[model samples]
Target: MTTKMVFAQPQPVLDARESDEWTSGICDCCDNKPQCCFAFWCCPCFACVKTRKYGQCLCLPLLDIFGPAHPATLAMRVSMRHRYGIKGTICKDCAIATFCTACAWCQMAREMDSRAIPIALVGTRPTQ
Candidate 1:
């Protein structure tokens, strides 16, 4: 007599639809008042701070000033949408980055906060 063993694969417990949208609207500045105020008062600094929190170089957003179009903001928005699986297109991202740059940065910051994604601070050593 010969015996064979069978293994079962695990399946997801929930079939609930994953959210393919941003946690807050681009103009939902009231969702995060402090961040919105900061962005409103000094957009460049706010963008740089938010970019650093997103684990990129602290000065990455400053590059936006050199171009007529907000390249840094658009790139960051596209990257964030892709990373979070948010449903949006490049054209939309470009338009928002161009027309509502401050709001775009604020929305990105709120998304990062809501998702609770871990951020590694620069020059900080890990403890064993």
Candidate 2:
């Protein structure tokens, strides 16, 4: 059985998500600074169980559009849909707006460039 890493202090000493040394080695969110946390499987960030406001990541569009959803992300979707009713389902366009990734809506997670913070410009969906 896989046991989750529970931190007593709820704060990581060194934030890997904020580290900028490695493009993929460190956490993706650790661009400004080191993202110290007590987890690494799904992701390492300050928005984990300790963040108090973290109910779930709930962006199903990202999972569906991006493919190969992580367990944490899936959990967030379930919570967002069933518990909080954030959104039943979101499209790629919505996720891009929600995640501010309109310019970098990558098809693959590994293809996401940590440094490439696309200009957060608003997008208008193409007419059908």
Candidate 3:
């Protein structure tokens, strides 16, 4: 007798167009006054908090001063965009990271908090 093994395929959790939703814009920080104040007054701490929430080291954002590239900020933005399948270009991400780092970070934090369900935890599953 011969035996065979089979593996189940995963399903798509969201609809095709679901990923097209726009994220919170960078200047929308005032939508949440407390969070806005935190980000504005303590940008480094806020950035560190946001980085840690993404499962990275809390102090990782401090690396931004090492260069104009703002590697840590870029990584967070890229990861967030990929996780949510958000429609955006790398040029935009780089520009935001390079010119408006604080606003970018604040927007990311708001996006993550505003989502009813965290994108990262929305695994592949059947859509009702």
Candidate 4:
């Protein structure tokens, strides 16, 4: 079945091309790709997302909001972490994390609390 994306009228006037400023993002669980309507956010692609699923959950910091990985995801991850002077894996174990299962790396780190200096800013709310 096709999911229809919806949008609400903006409370404030918005640039007609306002969407242009936003990167296209579908939840990891979303099967719908840009091949279908964008700006039409449906519920998180629940069926599409799975726990411990590879290639889900990670978002581009400083670029888009909670969104899917982009084509430049690898570069983005490296550069963003570097920008933050964020060395080492954000996940627990201070383990080195390669690109795949980026979310898992972070998830495990959170669960173990083995995260290194400056807990990973990804995954959970900042620890108080």
Candidate 5:
């Protein structure tokens, strides 16, 4: 007797367009005014909030201040790009994280917000 094994094919989670490029530009803060304003006024707080939203520890972004390389920002940006299948190079991510830290955080925030999926819970009603 011979036995055969079959594997299921993987399906994409996000739409095709989402995988092509960033939803907004690094400097397109106008795409999300409130996020931009918050990022501008309190960058650390904004970074912390965005970091938490990305499923990282709330204090993750605070580590960026200790090092000149802004490691936290670079990591977040690279992770986001990879998760979303956005086309970008690590060198570009490093440059953005190093030079435009606030804009980078804001761009990530906007991308996450745009791709957010709402969850709906269903409960059975009690009989009268």
Candidate 6:
């Protein structure tokens, strides 16, 4: 009987500091007037839609009522930035969530739209 020892090579690590910029500015809601109006007319509804599109439960946006520093919003912001490799810091996420929650959501939605990432396709995988 012969025993063989195999060595595994280390995988290359990408630089986390190299990140892309956001597709749209937080306050660029006017760029998409319909979505801007929808978000403005019924922010809660817009938030709910955004939450559901994020692959979370539709009611997750209800967490916003807990306070200005909303957990759901912060989590979504952080995840979106990470997923898209967008350049941002936790402090920036906190500021956006605390002060510009609606605009932030709108910007995220716009970013996804610009990227052609179907809202229905997120969190879903093709089955063989």
Total backbone collisions, model 4? 5
TM-score of 1: 0.77
TM-score of each: 0.77, 0.23, 0.73, 0.20, 0.80, 0.73
Better of 2 and 5 by TM-score: 5
Candidate 6's C-alpha lDDT? 0.80
How accurate locally is residue 40 in candidate 1, as Cα lDDT from 0 to 100? 94
- Model 3, 86-128: lDDT tens per residue? 8889899999999998888888998777554534554554444
What is the per-residue lDDT of model 2 for residues 15-94, given as tens digits with 9 covering 90 to 100? 22443222332124333232222222223232243222332343433343454434344444334334322233445324
**Candidate 5 local lDDT, residue 91:** 96
Q: Write the per-residue lDDT of candidate 5 for residues 1-128, one digit (tens) a residue.
A: 55554476444354445456988888799987988999999999999998998899999999998978899999999999888888999999999999999999999999988888765555645434
Pairs of residues at least 3 apart in sequence or in different chains that clash in candidate 2 = 14-36, 15-34, 15-35, 15-36, 16-35, 17-30, 18-30, 18-33, 18-34, 18-35
RMSD (Å) per prediction: 8.6, 21.2, 6.4, 20.7, 7.4, 7.7
The 0-to-1 C-alpha lDDT of every candidate, in the order given, reads: 0.88, 0.33, 0.81, 0.30, 0.87, 0.80
- Each candidate's clash count: 0, 10, 0, 5, 0, 0
Write model 1 residue lDDT over 1-128, tens digit each, in one string.
55554476444353333579999998899988988899999999999998998889999999999977999999999999988889999999999999999999999998888887444544634334
The true-versus-predicted C-alpha distance at residue 76 of model 5, in Å, is 0.5
- Measured by TM-score, the strongest candidate is 5
Worst 10 residues of 6 by lDDT: 117-126
Weakest 10 consecutive residues of candidate 2 by summed lDDT: 102-111
Off by over 4 Å in 6: 1-19, 118-128
lDDT of 2 at 67: 42
Query: Which pairs clash inside model 5?
Result: none
- The C-alpha local distance difference test score for the whole of candidate 2 amounts to 0.33
Any runs in candidate 2 off by more than 4 Å, and if so which? 1-43, 49-52, 55-68, 90-128
Residue 4 of model 4, lDDT score? 50
